[model samples]
Target: MSAIDNLPPLREVIATHQLSARKSLGQNFLLDLNLTAKIARQAGDLAACDVLEIGPGPGGLTRGLLSEGARKVVAIEKDTRCIAALQDIAAAYPGRLQIINGDALEIDPLQHLTPPVRIAANLPYNVGTELLVRWLTPPDWPPFWQSLTLMFQREVAERIVAQPGGKAYGRLAILAQWRCEARIAMSLPPEAFTPPPKVSSAVVHLTALPEPRYPADAATLSRVVAAAFNQRRKMLRASLKGMAPDIEDRLIAAGIKPTDRAEQISLEGFCALARELRRP
Candidate 1:
């Protein structure tokens, strides 16, 4: 039996179901219940929250969330072999567990969840960054979820929390930090997973701000940041030339030096530049 629940241990369940991790699906089964519970605890109190979990391979983390007393957990899994495996968990928890068998990239998890939502997952490596960007750039402010507790490669985690002027700071750093409070909650070694990934992993916790920290249109800010970072080595005036006719004047108007590279620009600086681009 698993330490956290009466359900079978993950290894035995995997053996019985012949559920081997597939590289193409970015599957890395986390078999340690102790570690999984620790990950769940990092999400804060789940007692009153409904969680959206992505890529719940063999339901290891799924069990962890449930054990922590989450009101409900909606898990999206792409692997068919794991559906029956997760059914075992669902039965153990009664109505608290809901399993959706489909691609996480295609499915909109919000439709299945209600208010007071928190997304907690050990995400598939390949789609982790894309998913984060999608969540960060939602059409509306004060997004559906109260917080995000997601696991990503250590490098990606560093990028998410990186400050201005650092090598890791770029588009992601601006997008994540401009409107949210993000931090690396914990780090895990490669050996933690059944099929160890070459790179280590870390969990990031991001809570959305009631309003953006600075004033700027999201679309314009994205374009400006993209342009600046796309040619990061170039000075702002040259890199943003395609974005505005009087790019140097706009840079000066924003109180930014024309010779500054993208890495040197703070989030507020980027917002100021984006605002200048929007002016008639």
Candidate 2:
């Protein structure tokens, strides 16, 4: 039995099922239950939350969430091979675990999940950023989930919580910080996985704020941020010239310098620019 639960150790489960980490699928199984449980705890109290976990290869984090007292867990797995192993977990927890065999991007998790939701996953490296963008940029304020505790490559995690003036800070920093309180909760070494990854990984925990830190139209902010960062090396004036004929004036009005580059601008500065651009 594993330290956290009665389920067999993850390596045994993987061997029994013949599951190997697939580079095409961005799979790196976290075989240590104690470690998975540690990652799960970063999500905060799960006793009242239904967690949505993506890419739960061989049921490591799935078992972690269950053992940690999550109210319920709805796990989405794209790999068909991992279903039977996950079923073993479901049986151990009875009604608390629901395993869905499908791609995370294609499936709508809200159908299976109830309110007060939190998402925790050791996300597939290939689609991790894309999934995070979707979650942070949903149509409305106060998204379906209350919080996100997700693992990503250390570089990607840095991008989420990075402040202005760093190479890592750009569109992702603006997008995430504009709407949520984000921070890196934990870091894992490359050797932690079954077949160790080349780079290290870290977990980012983001709690949704009731309202955005600064108010601006979401679409407009996204457009402005995207445009600015797409040509990050250029001065704001040069990069944003096509946005409006009076782009420099608008920049000055928003308290931003026309000479500044994208990475030098703060989330508030970007939101202010978005507001100015929204005006006639």
Per-residue lDDT of 193-273 in model 2, one digit per residue for the tens?
A: 978999999999999999999989999999998899999999999999988999999999999999999999989999999
Candidate 1 accuracy as TM-score: 0.98
Give one digit per residue, the lDDT tens place, for model 1 in 1-280.
Answer: 6789999899999999999999999888899998899899989999999999999989989999999999999999999999999999999999999999999889988888988999999999989999999989999998998889999999999999999878999999999998899999999999999899999999999998998999999999999999999999999889989998889999999999999999999999999988988999
Under the 3 Å rule for N, CA and C atoms, how many clashes does model 1 have? 0
C-alpha RMSD of each candidate structure in angstroms: 0.8, 0.6
TM-score of 2: 0.99
Residue pairs in candidate 1 whose N, alpha carbon or C atoms collide under 3 angstroms: none
RMSD of 2: 0.6
* Model 2: ten consecutive residues of lowest lDDT: 1-10
Clashing pairs in 2: none
